[model samples]
Target: MNKDIRITFRVTPEDYERIKTKADQAHMSVSAYVRAAALRHKVVVVEGLKEQTHEFKGIGRSLNQLTILAHEGRVSVVDLDSVFSALEKNYIGLCELAEQERR
Candidate 1:
């Protein structure tokens, strides 16, 4: 087993509240969250829409396969426009979500 060291630090009340809020939003304990932040690690907090998001990912995978098949002439034709548009929209939405989480 690896050994660990404990470190202590002080923060202003406002800073403490801010850290607590972020930790809550990330669904992590304050110490773990703070440690990760101090270590310059990336913290991803995926909120809600779990089932739907999973289904959306499956759809994306299918679209990717379809695109490859269409290019290979395995499929007579596939509407590339609609597929790309849907993917772009999903990408944009995820970006917006990440931006919101950052704030």
Candidate 2:
């Protein structure tokens, strides 16, 4: 910011403390931390989600392989069902998180 555009905002003391800690960890001043947060845009949010999506892709590949192995072999179907249930739960959780992050 070449010229200061002063604004006032409010948050809990605990949140201020947490931001202070994070700024210290990142070697930034609290003002910089707040400024960065205020400037966060949809592109930055999407980029963060892209990284998480990569993890989901890996999980999908592993699940696909497991499904193929179960189908080809005489493996117990109950175990596969359980795996799918867990995947469903995780997928729902991820969806919730992604939805919450949308601008």
Candidate 3:
């Protein structure tokens, strides 16, 4: 979008601070955050999600390494019931968090 137009509004200092805090949590600029809010967009702030994503990547790397080792006959494949359970739990937690934000 061109975004050639400008809109201005005034808020109390306290309101401004609250909006800024929310924007920071959402990792968006004030203008973008306000625009999304004005447009009724769903702006979700999922705390700790970035750390969880990094953990997931690490798990993926470990699984890939394990697969390679098994293929090379260097290590025997082990049960993955616990691993799957943990992943499922994390996924469900995230989903619940999102649902809470929507409400």
Which numbered prediction scores highest in lDDT against the true structure?
3
The lowest-lDDT stretch of 10 consecutive residues in candidate 1 is 46-55
Q: Between candidates 2 and 3, name the one with more favorable lDDT.
A: 3
On a 0 to 1 TM-score scale, where does candidate 1 land against the true structure? Answer: 0.42
Q: Which stretches of candidate 3 lie over 4 Å from their true place?
A: 1-43
- Residue pairs with clashing backbones, model 3: none
Clashing pairs in 2: none
Per-candidate local distance difference test: 0.80, 0.75, 0.85
Supply every candidate's count of residue pairs whose N, Cα or C atoms clash at under 3 angstroms.
0, 0, 0
Error of 1 at 77 (Å): 2.0
What does candidate 2's lDDT look like per residue over 8-87, in tens digits? 78989999999999999989999988778778854444435565577678778877887787898955453557557766
- Clash total of candidate 2: 0
Model 2 vs truth, CA RMSD: 11.5
User: What lDDT does candidate 1 reach at residue 42?
Assistant: 64
Per-model TM-score versus the true fold: 0.42, 0.38, 0.51
Model 1, residue 50: C-alpha shift (Å)? 3.7
